[model samples]
Target: MLNGHEEQEGVNKFEEKDGNSKNYDESDATVDRHRKILHTDNLKLQDEYQRLQQQNNKLQLLLAEYFQRKKCESRFSDECTDEEKERCYHNTLAKLKELQEECVDQKAHFEDQLKKLQEERQKTEDMVETELEIFVVYKREILLQTMKRHGGKRVSLEDLDRLQQVEERREKELARVQLENIKLNMRFSKYQEKFKAHSIGVDGQHLIDYEELKMENHTYNEKIEEQKEALQKVKKKISSTTHTLTQVKEKLEFIKAENLVKRGSLMKLEAHVNEKKEALKNLKQSRDSLWLDVKCLRCKSGLLRNVDLLQDFEDHCDSNDALKEKLDYLKMRYVQLTQNCREFRRKVQYAKQT
Candidate 1:
């Protein structure tokens, strides 16, 4: 009775092991299905990452092309950079400053020359007045001498003639002094008019030119600012693209780690399942051999009424058939899942292309 009880316990333990192995097999199949799904998802993510990279490259190329076009089209900045703009502005400012300085210098030069001319005119007028005083003194002396010689009597015609000749000479000297004064006044007037006209025309024209330069510079600055804004927008787009790519890469890494773990677990489960199958096969073979030996003994002894061994063996065979059916169902489900994943990938690709 104890032997039969121990044998029954062993059968129960074997059934429990078989049931546990069946559960493990089912769980492993589910894990494998999930792993495949994850693998497919990882592939999709990689494809998306590649597409984003391509888009980023295209954006970069477009940005480069735009910058090249701007450079070719621009007239202000040489390199289209901020420093270039500043340098150009400085050069323009320097030119304006030089022009202003030149105008100031010219005005100063004109003023100095005018002051010298005025001083010379004043000197000439003083010299003319002194010469006239000397001429009057000489005439008075000659008349006093004539009066002394005649002694208040009638004067000689010859003496009167001499006075007339001296008078003529003094009048000629006065006329020459007046002519030089007139010429000096005319020259001063001409210079003053020329200075006035030059200042008006040159200053006005320079001021107009400077204003035009400023307006052109203003327009150039506006264009530069607009280009800068455009560059900033492109940079933002590139940054966003890079950020998305980084996220995808992280996701791919996570998927790879998960795949490694799942692969390890699947291998372990497969090893366990194979061990269980070997054990079951060995047990079935031993049981069948024992059953044959017992039948041979019973037939030889003429005691062929025992059918428990055959019935027990048939029950174990039926259990194995049920397990095989379950395995087949799981495999069919895995195949369906793989098909579904493939279809999903195809749909995604089609959508992206459209």
Candidate 2:
């Protein structure tokens, strides 16, 4: 009986030890599974940290490149003359300050946008967590009811596998969001580069237009100066013409006064010539009367001499000779005066022709 009891005790102890060993093995497996999950979490964190560090390194390289380019451009600035350099420096400083202000504004706007995006993300996460919690609670109640109906039967393994697939799908959606964020950042960078290039092109075009406008303005100013000179010359010529006209008018007045004086002299000479012509006519009439008287007296004396009238006849003859001489002299003087009047008239007419 003791041996049987002792053997039975040994069997029980072995079975118990076997049970303990199985429990220990299961515990070890559970611990190993937990350790694997922890290692996965640690690896994920390490990868994220490495990615962040790489991003930082890329940003630093970009900044260094920008600074180097700026440094290289500084040498060209030294080539400008002092006056131009001073003006350019002031303008550049003003422009740089304006660009800095714009950048600051853009940064503030982007930060605000980021804050809004984060808030939206947080809301989405909360909603997802709430939905998950509700689903878990509902599933637990369904499981309990199913167990009650099936005398504690478990859910199907296929259903559990489907749930795991849904979880993976959610993880894929999160990864898609991350990829979209990366694409957006790249697009933003490309846009910035294009904008900078466009601004440079616009600035160059503006400078060219300004230079053309300046040249046009200078040309117009030259034309105005030429026109002003031409106007001044025209004014001088006009003044000279006006002065000449005044002189001509004065000369015309003098010519008119001289003509009046000459006209008065011509009238006096005409009056003298008319008086001499009248005296000549009177002398010729008197001569004709004397000839008639002498002829009549001779006839009478011839008759008387036959009857003793000889003395009277002699006296008459003497008187007739004296009268003849005086008549001749008067006729000569009249002819000379007539010739003088004709010569004077001829000279007056000639003077008018010249």
Clashing pairs in 1: none
Steric clashes per prediction: 0, 0
lDDT of 1 at 144: 38
Which lDDT tens digits does candidate 2 get at residues 1-354?
124345345345434543454554455455455545544544454444444444444544455556566568777667768898679669867876885676577667756765665565565556545555554454443333223322333443444345545555544554454444444444444433433433443567756655665565566556556655655655565566457445644643454454346446555666776788898888889888898998888787676645444566667888888889999998998999999999999999999999
What's the TM-score of every candidate structure? 0.24, 0.28
| lDDT for each residue of candidate 1 in 1-354, tens digit (9 for 90 to 100) | 124345345345434543454554455455455545544544454444444444444544454555566566676545578887679669856865785676567557755755665565455555545544554454344343334333443453455445546555544554454444444434444333433333433567656655665565566556556655655655565566457446644654464455456556666777898999999999999999999998888788652464776778789999999999999999999999999999999999999999
Clashing pairs in 2: none
- Give the range where candidate 2 is weakest over 10 consecutive residues by summed lDDT: 143-152
lDDT of 1 at 67: 56
On lDDT, the candidate that comes out on top is 1
What is the Cα-based TM-score of model 2? 0.28
